[model samples]
Every structure is written in C-alpha cells, then in structure tokens.
Target: MAKGKVAFVAHCLLNQNAKVAEFARLPGVVSPIIGKLREKDFIIEQLPCPEILAMGLTRWWTTRDIYDNPGYRRHCRNLAKFTADLIEDYYRRGFEIILVGLDGSPSSGVRYTGSSDPIWGGRPQATVDQYKIVPGKGIWIEELEKELQSRGIPFPRATGIPMDSQDFDMDKAVKEFEEFLGESSGVQG
Candidate 1:
C-alpha cells in the first residue's frame, strides 16, 4: 500500500467563514498555506471548530476562561479523542501526520493562544479588544495535546500560523507554514 502524508489543520485555516463575527481575515479559505500543503502531497484534515460546535456562529467574543468550564472541557476532550483516533490510524498505516493550528485563537492556537488574566467568567461585553492574547494553549488545543500524549503518539510538535491580527497576513502565514514543514523535514527555510 502506498502511504500518503497528512496534516491536521484548524478549521478556520480552511474556512474563514466559520470565524466569529468580524474576525475573519480572509474572504474564503487560507489559500496560501493550503496551496502549499497541496503542493507538498499532504492530505489536509480540517479539525472541527470546537467553539462553533459548542456555541452558535453568532456567539459573543470570549476568552479561554469562559470555555474553561467542565461542560466545554468535556466537549473538547471528546473532540480531541476523535482527532487522535484519526491520527493514530494514519500513523499505523505508515503515513506522516503534521498538526497545524491557528495562533492567538481561543480554541486552536498552538503557540500564542488567547487568555484572560483575571477570569472573565462570561462573554465579553465590549469588543475583542477588551481581552488580551497570551502565550499559551487554547482550550481545545490543550485537550488535544493531552490526548495525543496519553495515546503515546510520537508526532512532530505542532506548528502555528498567525491569524490573530485584525489584518491577517497571508504572506506571513505562508512563510511560517513553509518554514514549519521545512524544519520537520530537516530542510532549512
């Protein structure tokens, strides 16, 4: 059997339309990175949007603390299990799996996820500017990482593409994606 490369990407990376109101950086998919992934023979798997699943699209802007509740945590754990299962299956088949996440997101950020200094306790009343973006894992990403660790899945450490800026930089995102893939393959960017 021929083995294929696979990548698990955050949903917003593929569908900006699913992002919170006024938060979408691109009109459609994050084409630059997606284009490069396709060129690299990677079968991209778009992970489910945990926030969208838990709350509707029109849900108010929130921080990780708001989603830190038991219910939301359980939901994230279930989603993580499902994602891990797929990755494990691919790994067993001798396929390489790479995890990609959106930076500065409340659910999928890998490196610079958003968080509240003091717990917000609920959705923000003002705009997203009221909250701060910190260097940490988003709720779902945290759960996913834990799940992968528990399963003993030895995969490359996940890489993040910036998507927090009000004006998203496709060029930067593409460059980051290339650099990440290159590093994973022992090739310098």
Candidate 2:
C-alpha cells in the first residue's frame, strides 16, 4: 500500500514564546500523530494567515498589549471570518489528513469550530460549499512521529511547540521527532 501523506494545517505567525500556550489550547495538533505514523511522509504548513494569528495573539496578550493595539478588537472579528475561509480552502484541497487547531479564535457559528479543551476537541462545522472539517479522533502526534521516523520518511520541522507540555524533552522536540519518523510501525496498538 502507498504510504499516507499528512498535511498539517497550523496557525500563522508562529513564535516559540507563544507555542506553549498554543499547544495547550490544542495539545495534540501534531506531536502525538508524529509519534504514531512513523512511516508516513508529511508536509506541515502554517495556516499562512498572519492577520488571523495576530488577531488571536491580541486576545491572548495582556491587557496592556490589548490596550496598546486599539485595532486589536477589529482584528479579532476579521480574523475569525478569515480563519473560517482559510480552513475551508485547506479542507477543499482534499488532504488525506487535515489537522486544524483553532488555538485562539472562538466560534462565531460560521466556520468549523473545535473545542478549546483538547479532551473535547474536533468539532466540524459547515462552511465551504462542499468541504467540511469533520470531527475525528485526536491524533497521537508523538507516537505518530516515532512511527514515521522508523520508516525513514522526512518529517517537517516543528517551529512552535509548547515547552513543558509533552513528556519528551522540549529541546529535543524536533530531534526526537526526526528519530520518531525513522521508526517503523506494523502492529496497530
């Protein structure tokens, strides 16, 4: 069987300082899956929407930051709508696997909405003409990466991950990831 091609859809304006909070918002966005499908070749793309991430970061920022950026309020509204559209576009691409982590944006009842809580995440909403961000099992990124590495597939470098969230060493997050993707997987445990 041909190996699976996973395309990770990440938020734009990625910064390590905020990655921890971002990961906390959606814990298993990539890590767990990376650990599992070790043989799978993957292409992870940041959502490529700077306005959306900026808007979200605005909300997460301290009151001072919010106060500093008066346009922050408007950014949030426009960003919410932009995100919905962007997500729909990605979904329409018909990726075999699509992971959307709405880290900072809230549901406006327009685009697809996933839970802030990782445990109750993965909600698909109707937006695009045909595409739908359907709900599915939260992927085990670490295990997936481990499995992929064993297969010698190249894993995209993770730019922004939380520092203290996952069990694996934070500094080795990418290194371990590289190793994980080299491992092989057969038994579906």
Candidate 3:
C-alpha cells in the first residue's frame, strides 16, 4: 500500500560513517529521529552527501565560505537537479514531501549553516572553536531550492537536525523535529 508520504534527509543522519572523522555523533543511524519518521509512515530517502561526493572521503572540515565557489556550486546544482527530478515525480504523484537537513553542514544545512572567520583560508585550523552556526541555508540546499523553484515546485516543509550544538543535544533536536512534524500535520501536498 502506498502511503504517499516521503521524507528526504541528510545522508549523515542515516550513516554517521559518512561524516567527517571527528563529527560522527552516533555509531550508525540516528534511530530516534528515523524511528519517529517511520512511526509516521513516511518513506525515508537519504540525500547524497555533497562534500563526500565532491571532495572524497579524506576531505577536511571547512566552513560554508570555503565551499561557496563556482565549481562547488555547479556540482551542487547538478545534484540538486537530479534530486529535484525525483521530488517532482513524487509531487506529481501527490505525495507529501518533507525535507530533513543537517543543521550546521556547509553542504546540506537547511536553516542554519557553519561559518568561520574570513581569515580561514590556508591550512586546517588546530581547533574548531572559531566556527559559528548562523541562520542560513547551505550551498547544496540553496542549489536544490533554486532547482526546485526553476521547475515551479514549491519548496517542501523542512527541518534541521541540530548537530551544531556543543554537546550534540539529541533531546532538543527530537523536540524540534516533533514540533515540526506536528505543525506539518495540516499541510497538503
């Protein structure tokens, strides 16, 4: 039976192995969040990790400005167009589409992104304290939105998994997502 509901999520949410070495909070999947979506009967789809796709597994940690370039944006646009095609197909079929992003990812953040001082250019810093999480969409998310807009598809309801918090607040993340899901109950595809 088709439930006509789909949730597109950041890759690392389902596979922590895909994240940067020091950033993997879980051993594998984020069961709490994924379980909630499963309970709601929404089919989950993992979006491709733009950083891994573009820079390979050995890539170092960086800020949004580092990835905010023509080449990276073009690569993201291509990925977005492909994903948007899938999104359009589901939309055409009248499925409810929801987006879940990594809150501080340079490539996939939906509502808040990671940024650092303008002087961050050369070598990777000795520490990550200089990074700050601020309100904004990441490169890949922006490209995806633009791709969807060009195709005349309204952006889907989106929420972020807040990984930027110092302690990785799982409770807060779940609460926010639960609230978003509750609010989206009345939304129609």
Best by TM-score: 3
**Residue 147 CA displacement from its true place in model 1, Å:** 1.4
**Candidate 3 runs further than 4 Å off:** 1-3, 185-189
Native-to-model Cα distance after best TM-score fit, residue 167 in candidate 1, in Å:
5.6
Question: What tens digits encode model 2's per-residue C-alpha lDDT throughout 1-189?
Answer: 313344444442233234423333333344453434444565454443333256444333121212223364444435434443443343345433434333222221112222232222134432222222223211222222334455443333222222222232444645644463455531121
Q: TM-score for each prediction?
A: 0.88, 0.31, 0.94
Q: Candidate 2: what lDDT?
A: 0.34
Relative to the unseen true structure, what is the C-alpha lDDT of residue 44 in candidate 3, on a scale of 0 to 100?
A: 92
Q: In each prediction, how many residue pairs overlap at the backbone (N, C-alpha, C within less than 3 A)?
A: 0, 38, 0
Q: Is 2 or 3 the stronger prediction by lDDT?
A: 3
Point out where model 2 deviates above 4 Å: 1-39, 48-74, 100-161, 164-168, 171-189
Error of 2 at 102 (Å): 9.5
On TM-score, the stronger of 1 and 2 is 1
| Candidate 2 backbone overlaps, count | 38
lDDT of each: 0.79, 0.34, 0.85
Specify the highest-lDDT model's number.
Answer: 3
